[model samples]
Target: MNEQLIHSKITSMEIDVLRAVKQRTLEKFTEGPSVERARLFFLLLPYFDGKHWSGEIEASAKTVSIVYAALHAHDQVKENASATKKQQLTVLAGDFYSGIYYQMLANLNNITMIQRLATAIIKVSEKKASFHDGLDRTTAELDRSVQQIETELLATFYNFYGFDHYTPLATLMLSYIRYKDELECLQGGSETRIIRSLNETLQHPLHTERWLLEKLDNLHDQISLTINSYNFNYDLKNFMLHQITPHQHRAEQLTREG
Candidate 1:
């Protein structure tokens, strides 16, 4: 959120991590370079809360965001049989980011957060794998996986800093964001593992659309309920609701028409 502060912290550590991961061979072979901002904000949340902030903590957080970028990069991989250069790099991106996170934590002797984040990654991976598993999951089961994938890393960081108060709000909002994107994908005729699973489960794209609409409605209700449960101040809550999950009248119209 604070660009100067986060950029100052992120630029210093990101440069070092990039330097360490640099292999003249790999650099030449790679497709793109850099991290992302949404992830940076979640990583810096504890710092914003005035937690036990430090260079080591900030560096660790960057690696965590890098890890998310890695996974996210891979999630872009096409289901096509012929993988492109970008898709190939995506697979390595997640692996490379993971190695950097481990190395950074190891250098700092922050073995505990390493273990915590590793466990979080395992949960995230399993949930991600569920979408590709061809398993017949109910809407509840699918929703649970989505929640874990969105919140596991942030939840680990929150639990580490005794900032568990943010978990409920983060979980709700992130899940909302994810489902919102999923709905857009549905409307655009794009295929995602979740959309495919829903299609298979529902037996038609129309049913998939209905399923997604209902799912989003439920997630929005949950978000509202969970946000109210948090002790966050008015401004923070307003920012999340208005900025993050601003109500889309068009989306409501589509849902109603469906």
Candidate 2:
């Protein structure tokens, strides 16, 4: 697909997903879902590439976005120490979005994808919980968890639809984005679970910063190699490199400045 077609499709999916999860009270109180445009791009990549796509598949893709929105809603809930009105509603917003995903799938009669997504959610939740378990995990071990938290849902969707070739690229790109956000949070002094977990694992904020910078560099390289290995069209590859994954050297410059 050309850049316009790809971008248009992604924007359409974003609009559909946002409309799918809208709620007046939740919108009023809680931070809305953190549906990254990059993530949505990857979710719709198969369709963009003209894979085994159908309306059912496109509808399923929307539900996958809904699932991501559902999970991200819970991530907005503040720590138990501060249960404000927004925080209370944040939890319910997650549940409400989750229910919407289930109902959406049930209406499609897509029992198989529902089961697969449920399994993915379980694994993602387990990895997320490990952050709170007070385990002295090595940086590698912790990163694996973070990678799962970043990629499991998308991986599940890709695998279900025979788009497994995109898994490595997806994992690398998604983790890169997650680390990019974490790096930004560290610089901004924002408190987040990923930041706390990275601090605990790395033993210092500086070390966490260094680790994230290095990881981003490594992921960017891997993403380049993985994308090159695939025979994607010029437009797809260009959009991915220029639009999705950051330039690692530039990212390092910014991180060092911070």
The C-alpha TM-scores of every prediction are 0.80, 0.94
Look at candidate 1 and give me any clashing residue pairs: none
Provide the clash count, candidate 2. Answer: 0
Candidate 1 regions with alpha-carbon error over 4 angstroms: 1-36, 50-52, 249-252, 255-258
Candidate 1 structure quality by residue, lDDT tens digits, 73-111: 677667665766656776786687678778888888989
What tens digits encode model 2's per-residue C-alpha lDDT throughout 110-179? 9999999999999999999998898888888888999999999999999988899999889989898888
Measured by TM-score, how close is model 1 to the native structure?
Answer: 0.80
Question: In model 2, which regions exceed 4 Å deviation?
Answer: 250-258
- Native-to-model Cα distance after best TM-score fit, residue 82 in candidate 2, in Å: 3.5
RMSD of candidate 2 to the truth, in angstroms, is 1.9
Judging by lDDT against the true structure, name the best candidate.
2
Backbone clash count, each prediction separately: 0, 0
